[model samples]
Target: MIDLSSARLSRRGFLILGTVSASALILPPFLTAEATAANRYQPFSSRLSLTINGRQRQLDVDTRTTLLDTLRENLGLTGTKKGCDHGQCGACTVIVDDQRINSCLTLAVMHEGASITTIEGLGTPDALHPLQAAFIKHDGYQCGYCTPGQICSAVAVMKEIKAGVPSHASSSLIDAPTFEPREIRERISGNICRCGAYPNIIDAITEVAEASA
Candidate 1:
């Protein structure tokens, strides 16, 4: 290669080279069409269609959003509490396809086309579910924060017993789980009541179970 010092250089060629170098330094690589296409940004979001509380609903949510947030923030169904988002506490519990689950543990997009029911769907002020009424009679709504999850879980517990699903407290795995205090307590152990009102909660669930029976 000829040395630039020894080579004859036209004024226009040097000016053009200097201008191209400056443009490369000033402009971002992504500003180019090829760069933009190669580095396109894709949002982490998904559309979900769900039958919530007997109503058909559809919404778009971040793929990372939990079902608890979708219910409370997106759908305005705030009755499903968001305590201990790590899924240890059952405060974020809800019924999906007649089965109870911790809403905080699942992603909203994962339940597309699934039916869900929060505490608000159970009953209104005028018409209380048997469990809700029983809770009131038994004073089980101690602090009231964990009441939603407790009631939801209790509802599922009754269903599990009727469905003949065995639990750890059951006397035999082959037989249906008994609808007794020990079985009820075991089924609902995931729910925590900070108010330390376990006895009242158990009594309320027992009352509902007996009445339904």
Candidate 2:
């Protein structure tokens, strides 16, 4: 016969062993089931009001949806590119209250009452914004996937410069705040153009800076 008395563990040790066994049996199912249920649910449909492109727009959107998704999928504003769903790529950059931000990183629900300006709001074919026209003239883009974000970022960069925002490359020796190639490149480095059109993109910003001066 097994020596039950000799094999017996202390009450605390037995409790710990039983607790571990119970956790192993229940934890995995609870986590997996919760995640699966969350993924399967449709977007929460709630009417959201936002000011986009200087106009008030109202739409029903999922509370879990990102601002980029609401712009592209719900509002049909596809000018903001969705290069990477994550915030790593600046392709989804937009201006919110004069500050440039990645739309993909923000939720649509959070942008309520905020003024948002996307690529579509930047310029038109006939009256292109200086940055947009410069991009076209200097061939600042390649496959055109990152053009919108680049242009938007370029515009905001200028605004920042005009407001005396110093970049990491700023020289302490320089008497005046000169937005040279380094500053422009550093400011816009977040937006990656896979086609490798950095030179032309810099040139476009230079042209706009010159015109603005």
- Across residues 8-114, which tens digit of lDDT does each residue of candidate 2 receive? 79999989989999999989999999999988866567788899999999988889899999999998999999988898889999999899999999989888888
Provide backbone clash counts, one per model.
0, 0
Steric clash pairs (candidate 2): none
Candidate 1 per-residue lDDT over residues 1-213, each given as its tens digit = 869997676899889989999999878764786787988887787878999999999899999899999999999999999999998989998999989999999999999999998999999999999999999999997679999999988988899888887676645433457768777888899999988889999999988897787
Error of 2 at 142 (Å): 1.3
lDDT of 1 at 126: 100
lDDT of each: 0.89, 0.89
C-alpha RMSD for every candidate: 6.8, 6.2
